[model samples]
Target: MWVLIFWVLVINFLSAQEKFTVKKIVFIGNEKTKKEVIARELSFGVGSQIDTSDLAYSENRVYGTGLFNRVKIWAERDSGDSSIVYVWVNERWYIWPFPILGWKDRDLKKMFYGAGLIHTNFRGRNEKLIFSFALGYDPWIEAEYLNPWVLGSKNLFYSVEVFYQRVKNRSKILEEEFGSFYERHLSFALTFGKRYGLYKRFWGSIGFKEISTTGEVPYMKTLSPSGRDQMFVFGGGFRYDTRDIPIYPSRGFLVSVGYKFNRLVNCDCFFLQGGLEFQGFKKIGIGLIASRFFILNSFGREIPVYSHFYFGYNERIRGYFNDVFEGENIFGGTVEYRIPFVKQKFFKWNKAPLEEFSILRFGVDLVLFGDFGNTWFNREKVLKLRYLSGCGVGINFILPYDLILSVGFARNDTGRGQFFIDFKGGFE
Candidate 1:
């Protein structure tokens, strides 16, 4: 009996080493996504030699596209040395025509709202088209398009964006600070990018910007002919991302280094700015830990104060108000952990077309996060930099369409704390 068991184990080990040919590729639940688009992202195809490693990488590549909420790959053996690869994906809502509701600041009284049309699978090529008109504090109307694989090549992509906004000066809005006013700005930009290897991207852009102040802006006293400025700006950057899911990664690493040159075509000022960013994610037991570090520096000639870096807005640091700190050079990072106490599949539509697709999935997660950072205008002020730290706990609702709604309580170094709500989508 021992000899028979040993012989069986030897045979299985030998079989596992044999190379298997990919006989066919199949996709499930990609209703709006074109077959070619799915094929374009896969690392292996028909007649290719596939092993366990290839299967795992292929699944990750598809998930990294942010096209689906879940992806599962499996193989069905065929006659001798051949097999069929099956890919199952839960598709997110491709078309989103929804109302945009948000706050201009941390204060609930300053409400901002609007409506927009956002399409993720534009013509089934993984293209994005968005048109939005938001009103309230900083009113703006924006239209943008991003193509990840221009001309059907994974190595190239491009984006175009146009916006007209009445941006409010944070200092003025706070009332306690100086230089509060509104600026009317119109801008347009076109960028082209290239991808290298599996995780690197290089991009360049050319754009035009026009800005004019309304009301009183006390800080303009230091401006170099600052009343109204119009200029043509050009620059480029590089990014490297290996996150399995950018919005909500389970495990991976990301690095981005970029430089931008702003040449004042209508003025006498030009400056160069560079930035570095690093992010890491890892899973431990049932929870996941993630961290991000970033540094932004400016040089060349003096640029508009508006071009500088400011933290405490959106996702940068959670405990402070928007524009809490501003400077020419800024450094900061965050560490967060997400643990899911309840993870279960809800219900599945069993109707005609639904039967052909994968089932929907959902879960509830608890998040603990901390953030710290500071900004300074020059090296001399580095020692005087006022650093702020904050820690918070939050609840995350995981739903279909790669949507996560998070609400958390954060307490900063100021001994002041607030509860904040955040809406996140997978496509960014």
Candidate 2:
């Protein structure tokens, strides 16, 4: 009787242990991101017996992708067959609507509203499509497209874009003119290249662009001589970038050279431009940028259209307006001190409300910038060496979506101050 009882207890314990083992996993609450992607990142998988000891590790794997806002796992016992494992996920919404505010100098000049829809993952493919529109108070619509891949390869890439924009400008001497203009632009580029060792990269591409415009003249009458003008450009260039990121590069160098034929069929003019960028650091980060441009008519005469150089803004100097200074030769540099400010993590993986990850990072940057450039119809006639300098403070926020947003204010040597905001993806 005692031996029989011991045998029965042993059988029951074995059955219970088998029941707790996981044979399969089922995923839910995924619409944009794919299940296969999440599965590959997970520590647990089908046919693997469930181990409560590794639950935390499993959760961390899923959260690292930044695709989910929440994730959950559970199991159910089956009466006849293998136990069923359930993986529950909550998806983050893919749409955002926000306001846009910008200023050229110090005035709160423009107020606009914008909306965007992003699909980081679509149809199990890691593809993204974004659509955005902005309506200025003057009521203009600007649209653009960013296609990271067309051939679907990491080495070869293509980007095609079309834009239509209209705006009213305030005349320099006369009163404001409600001048309306329509512009249609199309650009296509093909690139092939590779990244070398750490801190070295090179890529080259040939591109074509067409720009046509019809509108009244505002600010500059030369831009529209006949009240309507059109330009077609074809060019190819080689680009070498060593920067950590193209948008907000922390360190690296970039060099590009290109020649364009403007009004190819009509005006028959040639334009050449080249630029070099250097990002380096000793104790503080420093960025240096310089460019030169030349334009010549079919008859080999210099043209005024290509006689100007543009400087300022996030591209060259920080804490400045877009295209604030114009010349034929541009030289600009910025020095910044990057410092960590705060960091906080939230959205526990087990308690995640959606199939998304959480990230928190904060930093402060002190920056000093200088810009100098000259413009002339002839290269021989250029401004002497002089630079405009400014210094500022900034705050940075790094988010899970690989987004970096920065806000800053800087004052020039002339006592004029400017406030600016910038953002970039992939790198800070």
In model 1, where is the ten-residue run with the lowest total lDDT? 5-14
Q: Kindly list the per-residue Cα lDDT of model 2 for residues 1-428, writing each as its tens digit.
A: 22233233332111223325567778887776667666655556666665543344455445444455556666677644556777666665554443555433222455555554555554544444555556754443333333333343243434344444443322222223434444444455444444333223355555554444445442143233443334554545555544433434443455554444444333434455445444443222132121222222121233323224444422334434543554444555554444445532443455545434332223343333333332333344335545565666666665544456667776666677787776621122
Candidate 2 lDDT trough over 10 residues, lowest sum:
288-297
Q: Model-by-model lDDT, in order?
A: 0.73, 0.45
Task: Note the clash tally of each candidate.
Answer: 1, 17
Maximum-TM-score candidate: 1
Q: Write the per-residue lDDT of candidate 1 for residues 219-290, one digit (tens) a residue.
A: 362234656777777888888887766766666788888887777655677788888889887765456666
What shift in Å separates residue 3 of candidate 2 from its native position after superposition? 88
- The lDDT, on a scale of 0 to 1, for candidate 2 is 0.45
Estimated TM-score for each candidate: 0.81, 0.55
